[model samples]
Target: MELTLVDLSVARGGVPVLAGVSLSLAPGQALVLRGPNGSGKTTLLRTIAGLQPALSGQVTGAEDRIAYAGHADGLKAMLSVRENLTFWAAVFGMRDVEQAMQAFALLPLADRLAGTLSAGQKRRLGLARLLVTGRPIWVLDEPTVSLDADAVALFAGAVRAHLAAGGMALIATHIDLGLDAAVLDVTPYRVALNGVGFGSSDEAFL
Candidate 1:
């Protein structure tokens, strides 16, 4: 599968953020969006995931294959770790939680309440839900917050496994996710609203 964006324009809060962006991603490939904090990385990812509408232009090739994971973990506080994954799996029409449990190292926390896990542990459980969704295209926004070094490695391994299975991923992150992904700095596509639609700045993402 492949996702192609041609001259895509995206906005947040009814204001243009990213304008005239174009890119293409194929199976087994990953695209990383990098830019300053306010450079619309989240907006662009949401647009690609179909969570929000685009202002203009076209986004093609990605239909129902998108699985979006935003900044929030989206876990039920009272539910156990396994319960959360199983719930999402059922919602996404899957029955297997074994892979997801091992993917994020959630097996150790399987019986633990989501509310009891640390921030990093909760993040892992949240990410594990993606495996059960069975979607081919992953749209993630800052997926590694609060994760320790070991957990980050585990996350990277999961991504690589997904790619090996011919899945594509689009991630918007500050620090590295450890994937050898194509980096697209969105700084150039940002639209400034100083009563005008275009401008330039010197801030680059690290």
Candidate 2:
């Protein structure tokens, strides 16, 4: 799959967060969106994922073409890991939740309540949900949060394998996800009150 962002900007409460950000991505590639807190990383990710509306510019990618993992795991607090995956699989119309559970190494925690799992475990479970969806583009927001080195490596390995399988990703991370992906910065594209948008700057978001 290929995605093109043409002069995209996002605003919250009428204050511009991201301004005139444009980029192109294709399968087997990854673009890291790196920035400090409140620098529009999350906003950009949300816009790309269609969770948030774009203030200006155009987002023409297929709506279901991308799967998003936000800062929150978005797991059902009352459900067990297995039940959560099962629910998501059914929601996404997957035929096999067990396959996805095993893929993410959640077999052991299948019976554990999602709310009771550690942060790392929860993040892994969240990532597992993405696998079950089978979408080609992954929009991850701080996917490594609360993960230990080993889990981080596991996440990175999963990402590498995805890219190898012709998948693409857009990651917004404060910590290194170790994906060897290219970086893009939204700082240079911040919308000024009087500017036309994406005004000819090439600041790196990574």
Candidate 3:
């Protein structure tokens, strides 16, 4: 499978953030987006995940095959660790959460409420859902925010296995992901901050 963007333009709050961006990724491949803060990395990832739309241009190969994990853990505080994964798995038409638990070292805390887990644990639980979602393309935004070093390694291993199994990942992160992937600097795609949106015909260029 492949995900490709052609001259994509994206916006937030009805204002353009990224413009004329293009990239492609194949199975068993990853693209690590790196840029200074406010460079539109998150907007780009959200567009690819279908959570948001591109203002202009096209995104192909990412129709119904995306599993997006954003900065928030997205867990129900009252739900147990196992229940959390199970719920998402079922929502995605998957039936197993065992592998997800084991993948993120969450089995020990399976019955623990999500609200009680430490930040690192909660982050792992969030990541574990990716496996159960059973989607081929993973769109991750700042996936390692609160993880410890070992947890980060585990996350990297899981991503490696997914890619090895012909999955694709598009990650927006500032920290190292400990993977071999292409790095895209989004600075150039950032829309000018001169009070003009992609809707404007005459605007400043950076």
lDDT tens per residue, model 2, 1-206: 48889988887556676777889898899999866555677778888889778889988764788899987799998999999988888888886788667766789999999999988899989998888788889999888888888888778888888899999988887667767789987667655646433322212221
Comparing 1 and 2 by lDDT, which wins?
Answer: 1
The residue-level lDDT of candidate 2 at 133 comes to: 85
Clashes of each: 0, 3, 0
- Computed on alpha carbons, the lDDT of every model, listed in order, comes to 0.88, 0.80, 0.88
Query: What's the true lDDT of residue 194 in model 2?
Result: 60
Off by over 4 Å in 3: 196-206
* Model 3 vs truth, CA RMSD: 4.5
Q: After superposition, how far is residue 20 of candidate 2 from its true place, in Å?
A: 1.3
Give candidate 3's total backbone clashes. 0
